[model samples]
Target: MKSSMATPVTVSDITENPHKYQFKQINDMTGQSILNSFDAVFISNSVAFNGGLNVLKDSIYHETINKDMRYNINIIKTAKKNENNKELKKLVKLFHSKEIQEYVGKKFDHKKVEVKKQVSYLK
Candidate 1:
């Protein structure tokens, strides 16, 4: 029973049935407001990049809802458009850059694509 409740907690239901902790439904979920009022928050991992982690000093721990589940970010270019658009090339280059790739990978969970090795690494 404990394990079942621990695994998947209906966050919405918590409001309906409160324990010792009092709840405050604030429209603004900024770190400052959260720290001043709320005990905890359920937010995206992306929040770590947007100064959220910095603000939530001690309240930094979080649990992933789905470890195996992953959302892929597909950058699909629009119809034909232009074959040699300098701006477009620059944009693509910026997105592909190591710094940008690293930032995105860390913040947005969009990993940089790696080339396959010629030699098989099978054990």
Candidate 2:
């Protein structure tokens, strides 16, 4: 005669029942706690340029780890558009100037941030 009892195979076998398993989403508090525990984070140049990193304070240090990343500022207008709005033209020109490029590079401590002249709105 055979025994009626069965041996347990593994933890997975004990928890494999769908009715006994549950999944929960991570809340904001838990998410923030995880972020706070990290020593460093990699963020895009645009975020740093916009002063997003200031929130991290001096406890965390950051550098532009990726030099190839680029951000573009585009001015969109109708296809038949002409330079009728002087102020808009001036703003576009100012954005493409070397002065503005130098300012952005210095502001973010990133040498790669510069006006992409080939794809300039003026072109």
Candidate 3:
């Protein structure tokens, strides 16, 4: 005999009727946001570190830390035949006296490009 007051729960019941039990929805939107934010920060930091590292690796830094100006100076130092290249000459002299070796060698030194933050909402 079947009781009219009893509820019949089948496999389909759980999927179709959510009100009969506690329903759980695993939405990854929040997780995706956190992951995206983390990835952005990691990528930005990586780029910044690489930029700073390249500058440090390529330039002669005995005192002050400088970036791409080293290439100009190198060009000036090497271009002895062309006396009329005054534009190049001036840029070399502009950054000639600066030496920034130790700054680049520092452990914590990095050129940060961007930063990211995470937020969440509850409903």
Candidate 1 C-alpha lDDT tens digits along 6-114: 4553434464443666555443336444654555655443343354453234346643323222232234254576747888878877877788778856764442242
> In candidate 3, what are the lDDT values of residues 10-119, reduced to their tens digit?
33445455445443332233432343343222112334344443333433332232332222122223455765687876765554323433343344353311111111
lDDT on C-alpha atoms for all candidate structures: 0.46, 0.45, 0.34
Off by over 4 Å in 1: 1-24, 43-52, 55-86, 99-123
What does candidate 2's lDDT look like per residue over 13-42, in tens digits? Answer: 444456654433333334333545554433
Error of 2 at 86 (Å): 2.0
Lowest-scoring 10 consecutive residues by lDDT in candidate 2? Answer: 1-10
Question: Which residue runs does candidate 2 get wrong by more than 4 Å?
Answer: 1-83, 115-123
Residue 49: error of model 1 in Å?
A: 5.8
**The best candidate in terms of lDDT:** 1
Residue runs of model 3 more than 4 Å from their true location after superposition: 1-48, 51-82, 99-123
TM-score between model 2 and native? 0.33
Q: Give lDDT: candidate 1, residue 85.
A: 83
Residue 76, candidate 2: Cα error in Å is 6.6
Task: Estimate the Cα RMSD of every predicted model relative to the unseen true structure.
Answer: 10.1, 16.6, 24.2
